[model samples]
Target: MSGMDPSAVPGPTVVDRRRLVFGVLPAAALLAAGCGRSNDDRSDGGRSARPPLALVYNGPQGCPACPETVAALLRGAPRPYRVEYVGGETPLTAAALADARLYVQPGGGADLKGTWRHLEGSAGAIRNWVREGGGFLGLCFGAYLAGRNPGFDLLPGDTNGYIDSPGATVTDGRDTVVPVNWQGRPRHMYFQDGPAFFLDPGADATVLATYPNKTAAVVVAPYGKGRVGVSGPHPEADASWYADKDLSNPDGVHFDLAYELIEATAGRR
Candidate 1:
């Protein structure tokens, strides 16, 4: 978290609890400890450990749950991951993403234009990166931003087309718990007014999951040599999210799904 500022996103919700839960432990440390962060992992290895997967964290949209997203990825990732936070003065650049294997756009509540502005000229870089076999994961707002916007248009054929963006794809600003049919079972997950993919005819995207309305809740599309996956709900929601929403998952079925999502995005790598 040294190179990133979790508090940069101005809002009442953007809290930095990453340090509290993670402390001096790096991502790999948390993994060795167990599914939950434990003090035992601290003595396992030095902080110089570098995982095979490299991720870029896009933080310009002022995502309050950005840190939580990172925590979930670290806890559930199939392989070791290294994250590079991109935003503020340190704009997301082609050079930065050159060596990264995956890029994650965390959930946030901010104007698309303003959020997209952070990567003004970096869209092509991102597109090219993924097109060359890199991976991209968009969560909630990140999924919405990936649709065709005023910027580079990472995911085209979106129903909104940058006009009334988020257009008929979502229930305008509505945040609530919703049921998602994943694989083949129903899973209750946290849904903020996230984009339900309405791909145009002949769209190359593949539906990974669907909402009750049959609208795409999660999708993976091929862009040249790379692949991009977007999810309309927060599978990585932490305990605080469930507590505030008065929701419970005794079996932790939803939590395990987060790892599945990550594996799907990581693809064969």
Candidate 2:
């Protein structure tokens, strides 16, 4: 990873959590009505009281599989949790995040700048929310958005395409599985135009996984009192996403990696 000059990037805007609470309550209420049904919906014979929510961005900026795949992964978490869709018609407002334990920004198409355009409105809200102890998980394109340039500036460093990194194995944007060392365990995970994180000097970010090139592929860091986790691969991807690609994970479909990320970002691990 390369060192970045922290001064070159704007830092997070400080906001009083108390003021944010009172300001967005009404908007959050209206936004919640349009969110997706919880995994614990009573109509599905699940518990009447919904568990804590994980709000996922399902807007046009994200790929078709991004939102649903992530929601499926969240449903398999160790603890009880609910899934809610945000973005597009349902904007991600401060109120919408009030009750959410986590906010996920999934992989999108290759256009990072375009994705930021759609998400710029919620940038301040997300930054402030995470600072107040809410968790954030970014996957693939989402990880790119966690950087300083064309992103939310959540990380002290910057992000670049993994395909262009030194010693990178997968050199294209095709759908395929690539080699990764996840916490010292060898594994193959779905990859596309993922990102390689470059932390600034002395930044206290934890590297959870690495590309074959040994660049940071997955990392977790502190944002005020909250936590931020970003992955360069698609751990939330399901079998359906691999169809016709002739690709497969020897370990089969699993949510372990995704769950690990959730747990870490939510401060449960």
Candidate 3:
């Protein structure tokens, strides 16, 4: 091993890792020495990196795993993403509702559990945005929020079950797990006030998981020119949510599916 030590590599050596990993790399002659960031293929010639995403969460209901999700995204997201809590704020305030490339909705717990009140005004803009090639993702309540037909009428449907306003308590069956993938497989969800999942004809929703009652646990569909995703379970619930006032019990499968749908639908491009 008298050759160059692997650690001595400098900046801007490899162009694309995929090109190197697959063993189909171009001639080594084209490859530069050392490894680092490059200015080519960048907008400003690498003057600076792309900005982090600004994600807004409407409603007063807070997500326990919100922080974790943001951390995970910042750590691993292909692009940067920032999280913000937007309660009582109009959707039109941000470009996301008007013309975002990808939009993600985190679990707003009870804030979005009302009579579709918060989104009543921005429904049309939301639909238009999706139909215009903007990606939409709904996690737990986020899915429910995106499924609302609102102004666009792109998706027409409603979430089943009835409960009081933000702090109403609904008793759970303790062992009554409405499995997302299949019955008997319990996904831990707590403090939920009867958020039964359902799908309507207008929604054109696809089922990724469900409860024994046949309600759609997870659904995905295309509306107009955009794609929408819904999750009945709270895959965003991380270890903190599980230990604290957890909503849906943290199920590995649910999180994987949520993350997958989120990336597919609302990834920052």
Candidate 2 ranges with C-alpha deviation above 4 Å? 1-49, 267-269
What are the lDDT scores of the predictions, listed in order?
0.57, 0.69, 0.43
> lDDT of candidate 3 vs native?
0.43
Total clashing residue pairs per candidate? 1, 0, 13
Q: After superposition, how far is residue 41 of candidate 2 from its true place, in Å?
A: 6.5
Residue 207 alpha-carbon offset, candidate 3, angstroms: 0.9
Q: What would the per-residue lDDT of candidate 3 be over residues 190-268, giving only the tens digit for each residue?
A: 2222234445655565666555455555666776677776555555444443333222344432344445656656533
Q: What's the distance in Å from true for residue 261, model 2?
A: 0.9
List the candidates ranked by lDDT, beginning with the highest: 2, 1, 3
Segments in model 3 whose C-alpha atoms lie over 4 Å from true places:
1-54, 62-91, 94-99, 111-118, 147-156, 162-178, 182-191, 194-196, 201-203, 245-254, 267-269
TM-score of 2: 0.80
Compute the lDDT for candidate 2.
0.69
- Where's the lowest-lDDT run of ten residues in candidate 2? 28-37
lDDT of 1 at 230: 84
Model 2 lDDT tens row, 1-269? 11113322111111111222234322211110001112333222367776678898987652454566677678766764678889877899999988888999876444455566788899999999999898989887678778765678898687887877888897654556788899989988877657888899899899999998899999999998899999888787666555434568877867788788888888321
